[model samples]
Target: MSRDDRQARRGYHHGNLKQALVDATLELVVERGPQGFTMAEAARKAGVSAGAPYRHFKGREEIIEEAARQGFEMFADLMEHAYASAPPSALARFEATGRAYLAFARKFPGHYITMFESGLPIAQNSDLKRTTDRAFAVLTRAAEELIARMPKDKRPPASMVSNHIWAMSHGVVELFSRGQPGTKTPFAPEDLLESGIGIYLRGLGLIERDD
Candidate 1:
């Protein structure tokens, strides 16, 4: 066996080696993009021998994939909590979820980037797929609730509305929240998202009634 493999086999007995590798991988992901580094580099950064990471991850891709998976899990939890704690109004709950989405991106920039921009093969990772789907389901559920309250003839399809809201929220985060160059908005990202959603609802003829 290669010397690196021997070192990795030794590392398997270290109680915290797996977590150490994961932490090191996260640091690397932030400094370099997810695809920027290798498993050996992560092991070295973690203060372990080059082969140490092999005990925890099959390869560098698995390391990045796990990071992305954890990120999605956190994202889904944040959305769920936002929805659950929101005011009784459907609109309020929906708006709260949007705000939570933006807050998550801001609070955990590294996780957010990996979760959305890592370019990991989510289709091949059931855990990642499930976590991502859970996060998205929050938005879709909120949309369904809102549409259910409208007159059937006046309601837009829940799936389409959900997609529109998700697109708008993501756009606001990328363009305004992240401070990307070009068209600067006077409004804060949160306000912009709120106002944009309001306008969209109004355009759909879904007027908000004072509760």
Candidate 2:
């Protein structure tokens, strides 16, 4: 091989190896479910020798786990920004965080699937668990702020409120936002989520009729 071609090839192998593998894994994940593809395929897609990936990742599972870890960090940042960008009203901030959840799922479908559907438990990795908790905490923080508006005697546990709303938001994303073609819902996911939160708040007597 010519010296210039060899130089270029060397750069390809060494340049940002981990990120290239991660990006390749994400593409494969979108094209095929997490378990559907092999490590060799990931190397091929990343344009490296089949053995190149082992320098950065032990196996496909590690690649997917890394993707999930990054996804949660990005998810937490988006939710934090959404919570801050809204008006100070507790309801508005709470709703903003919920919308952010849907937005992340739609924009990062591969990450979403790997993070939630790949059957990798976040608790297995301390860093992954911390990242996941940060993302979930944004929702719980919003819930606590919103629920605080209620009379203390009538307030529900913030964890309960957050978990319920998280479950509702997750359902909307999976059924509607995740590009599921056959599943039909008459209402847009945003409408469904906002109105559902409203109803839940009203049911708890946390939402006053006047405003």
Top lDDT prediction, candidate number: 2
* Worst 10-residue lDDT window, candidate 1: 4-13
Steric clash pairs (candidate 1): none
Candidate 1 — which residues are off by over 4 angstroms? 1-14, 179-185, 208-211
lDDT of 1 by residue, 119-152 (tens): 8888888999999899989988998888797888
Q: Please, what is the whole-model Cα lDDT of each candidate in the order they appear?
A: 0.82, 0.86
lDDT by residue for model 2 (16-48), tens: 868877888888898888999998888777777
How many residue pairs in model 2 have overlapping backbones?
Answer: 0
The prediction achieving the highest TM-score against the true structure is 2
Backbone clashes, each candidate: 0, 0
